[model samples]
Target chain A: MMFYIHKAACISPQQTFGDIDIEQLHVAVDNKLYAIEPKYPHFNGNALRRMSKSTRMGAGAALPLLADNDKPNGIIIGTQVSGMEENGKFLNQIIEYNEDMLTPGSFVQGTPNTISSQIALINNNKNYNLTHVHRGLAFENAALDAAMLVNENPAHTYLLGGVDEISANNYTLDTLGGWFKKEPCPSDGLYNSTTAGSLSGEGATMFTVSGNQAGAIAKLSAITTIHSSDVAVVKERIKNFISKELPDGKKIDLLLTGENGDARVFPFYQACEEILDDQTAIARFKHMSGEYPTASSFALWLACNFVGGILNIPRHMIKRHGDLKSLKNILVYNTHKVGQHGCMLVNVA
Target chain B: MDRIVVTGIGVISAIGHSVNENHAALVMGKTGIIKGGGNFPSRYSGLLPFGEVLVSTDELKTKLNVTQPGVTRTTLLALHAFKEAIADAGLSPDELSAHDTALVGATTVGGMCLTDELYANTHGDTENVEYVRSFDYASVNLFIQNRYNITGVVNTMNTACSSSANAIMYGCRLIKNGLASRVIVGGADSLAKFTVNGFNALRILSDEACTPFDQNRKGLNLGEGAAFLVLEKESDATGKKNYACVSGYGNANDAYHPSSLSPEGDGPYLAMKSALESAGLNPADIDFINAHGTGTENNDEVESRAMLNLFGTLPNFASTKGFTGHTLGAASAIEAVYSVLNIDRQELYPNLNFSEPIADIRLQPVMDHRSAAITHVMSNSFGFGGNCTSLVFSKP
Candidate 1:
């Protein structure tokens, strides 16, 4: 049931695209992190003008991973709040102008699947297209969908991705909802904070996946999502997942935990750590990418880079750096406040 | 892959409230398109006809015994259908709360149906703060999952009009992949100012009742409702009363326009062809097609071309949108129930309000209700952003 990752591209707050060195990670300013903007001069001017930030980031991240000669068999995207800026504008116009003289541009671009459709139209890919918006489980669901596609139809390669954007109004709303910390903290300080909320961040990560293993960057082993708020139940589930994936009692090389510095949710990560072997090196990424619903996609991207030997582990993000001879297996665990727990396993290709 | 079968179905629309009622209305050629009522207040309220659910929010609350504040109409409609589906399937509370039972729901307008309330609340109007948590796209599904204590793989999809079709497809995949034994797949969407104004801006709302496949057809009338079907593996549904088997399904994007399909209907053609291939059946095996005919000029013409391209000679085809209007996310699920009904009852419901077919294609739909031995039925659902999905249901 393993699928190969042919290519991986990410447009995030870090220096992921056209990277020089992963060691020199980009830093956020004023407790906010935005994806590195992409420039697309070749796109049609009219279409480009109508594309929202989510669409731009999605298309930009996908352009590099897609081969010019081969069209994907399908395009699946996972997003938390797709086109929030456009949707907010649409709502604002309805309220401000009393629903009169409202434009359709924002409303048209505000759907969650607009990113996938835009990418399909740009690439002329008339394949299976879908979008999932299930909070933190969105990207994992997309990945699972890609895996299912590959399993069902092994002849075609698929494009899977996660895209989200941070807007001022959305940030203000999240602040009021106690989703963002009041004080500014450096990206490295996120894992250690005892704050009520974590810093807000957004990005888009795209991967080319298929059954073909030739020249794969990494291999996706397993993905599982559990909907539970009980810490004990989640802990047991994680234990069963690890044993099921590694039935031979093999040690996990590295673990990536989505500890976003929210004090209320950190215990779930701690419970995950309790099940890991003492030698399993634990790493954190929300410190670098900040906290978004699809932050796990960023973690997957980082794990692929690490397994591919393109990135080195940062000392500050590790809780208990385990000793391993080589990078063989990596596990990513993430949880959302809405009771979605997801675990993804990846290995060196 | 294991055979997937539908064990139960539930539906609530402008035309009817349950499967029996909707079937009766369909057989009688009843139309639910009427002048606007309910809480939807718009500038074009009286001028434009909409397929509004006859029940008011208060009435729905009283009927369902809903006591929770800030519950949107979208969730209420979903709960109504979901409860019916589960009950019809004879699922107990313990079985529903099992870890192997999954729930996949879809909705374009979740809590956003309360457009004014959300807009006011987001603007520092703290009086309706309770509504803030209900604004997410997963609110309806979450509410249903929590109510039924569904602990399995719960996911929400939002792919515009094709949302529920994709949900059903996803549920099938989960069972085929051995991830779950049973999955409830459906979608719900209530009428909202957000959608009304959005469609108005697109100029697709019809002032009169829609006339699908007719030469002088006006645009579509927006509708609201919810529908769901309980899906389980054939082995697990041994003793259950199976409505129909979900033999095959396919999804594709048009890659053409955001709001309109290509004149050639490439996406629709490929989706239908793929579904046939997945079902291991030729085009001739299909007894009927439930077209995604939104009663719009662009959709009808393009879909007709697509059907012509695939079947060469079209089969018995009709668009139920003429009866219930376009229910957006809920359209495909509702149509899926209709497809099952067609199979189980061996019936063909007429395409209401159709005088003549499109001049170019010149293919006329069934003009009257009739009984026929049907083997397989194909249901098509196309959405904004060119998302097209086709599902095949076979007699069980």
Candidate 2:
């Protein structure tokens, strides 16, 4: 069963949140890109004081999507890593103070579900809430859950999203673990790098999804993930998925590939490219959003608005061309370092 | 919709290391709470009681024949329970590696159980850098997936105490949606200084054994363990030993506070009502309820109020936290296994250390072990962040 995206919001490294304009893409000065945060005046001072960066970003992105006095029936969030900064602070205290005088603020705020729960608490929404924490399949899992929920209960709306944060400690750990590029590179030049790691980025994207399509920007047809390292297996799975999803011979107009600058997994993108139709426009988004687990969420937000004619596709990210007649179906494919691939199909509403 | 049934079960807690052992301990009304004694050293060693598994890390490694370096205690405990579940289901390694077999595991402290080592490594101590990559919540499931060659959809969930219940619910959804034919669902967590200290700071750690539903219940005793259940479609489990059928499940958030439930128990009421609706049954159809009674003053009273609001006369309900303490993420899955056991054995386990009921509700829990024909059992799990989940298990 398909679910519709009613409204979408994002707080990414680019100016993609309110009234997004692709012409004003924010460029990163260093290897890391930070989300452009927005002011939140609705939260009380004491409540705002206790929230971590991720919580604030998530709430900031989600609260605006809801109309006045709107309460969603559920809140589902997907986060690769949550509260890293708070966790780091707590761990530092444990080491510096010998675990005796440890404070509870950081420890309490460091849980991964705090983002989703905080959104629910702020909205006074007591509904079906859950958080998925898979490496790269996090957002896809959340979307899939939302789809199932709407399919089961057609009357209820849901707040579905993904959030991830990058702290100094997290960045250093990623660098040490070979997850970030050694030399600094411009954000727009991400796809041109001949390096092993991709630029690190963080963002939070939330959407109001339901069966109702009165104000929907896009229709989510399918969302799935396959776990395989072999390019041949992944290619076959994609072919099968396309065949199953597009049984009426409906061709895809655009394809969004999760091709970061990393050369290690470029072959997976190549496999996907080899199977796509020649007329399909192939585009990349990681260069602007940077590469992080759940970055596909930002890509989805961009696709929804781009199809809705509210945002334009940056010329540098596009590789192939499709005639702009009607601008219908778009597909997104993303993968993680450990061989988890996800695919999402969104169509113009 | 395809009917999902539990084909195999495995568990390892402070009370026992296997299903039969745990069931025996439950039938005998044996509590596992004790004054701390385990591999980890804590400042509250002599003062606080905890439900600690009685095995050392080295001993677990040796018994499991684990040769991989830097395997966290969380992974070891999960592997131990997963191996037993697969064996109980009579699934060969080849069957387990099938592309249609999905694995869904939950945990709050995956590799973070090695708190001191993680602290040292992240703080630039550099002595235990090998555990750097194993600190994420997915590390334990990834280790299991790679070790067992589970090629299908694998995911990790961390919803605090209600984690594994949600995992089980997700696995059932996968099967019903034809995403998988069989799924292994459960969770694992290990005792660590991080959790102990975190709970201590919240002032919810009871100094003595927890007494659920008691008038003077102080708080909860933190515990750690793992449990797994193999769920297969009814058509696929024709020849297998079916424990019970997963009839219904629901999840909701309180949206009240980060660590406390609302006095009205709105989330709990909605979750229970949704579960009953999904099961196509009324409140009168439920024979027993495995309450989410953490022995905390707020939880027991609020849960009682929710139950009273739903069923004017409560069922024969009790909290096994007195036996196993609060296992956090593992509590739901462990309670699920106990619920299945109650159906399979047609027995009711007693609620230990409950001498007096609360003053307001004045409701007494099941205090005597007895044999009865229980057709349906409902298990509840509520956690931090106001997440609440309920699952109904019916006799097959």
Write candidate 2's Cα lDDT for A236-263 as tens digits: 9998888789648688888898898888
Q: How do the residues B221-281 of candidate 1 rate in per-residue lDDT, one tens digit apiece?
A: 9999999999998888889999999999989999999888999999999889999998999
DockQ of each: 0.67, 0.61
User: Tell me, what's the RMSD of every candidate?
Assistant: 1.6, 1.8
| Leading candidate by lDDT | 1
Steric overlap count per candidate: 0, 0
Q: What CA RMSD would candidate 1 show? A: 1.6
Error of 1 at A132 (Å): 1.2
Positional deviation of residue A37's Cα in model 1 after best superposition, in angstroms:
1.1
**Tens digits of per-residue lDDT for model 2, B240-339:** 9999999999898888988889999998888898899889889999999999999999999999999999999999999999988898878999999999
Estimate the TM-score of every prediction: 0.97, 0.96
> Model 1 — TM-score against the truth?
0.97
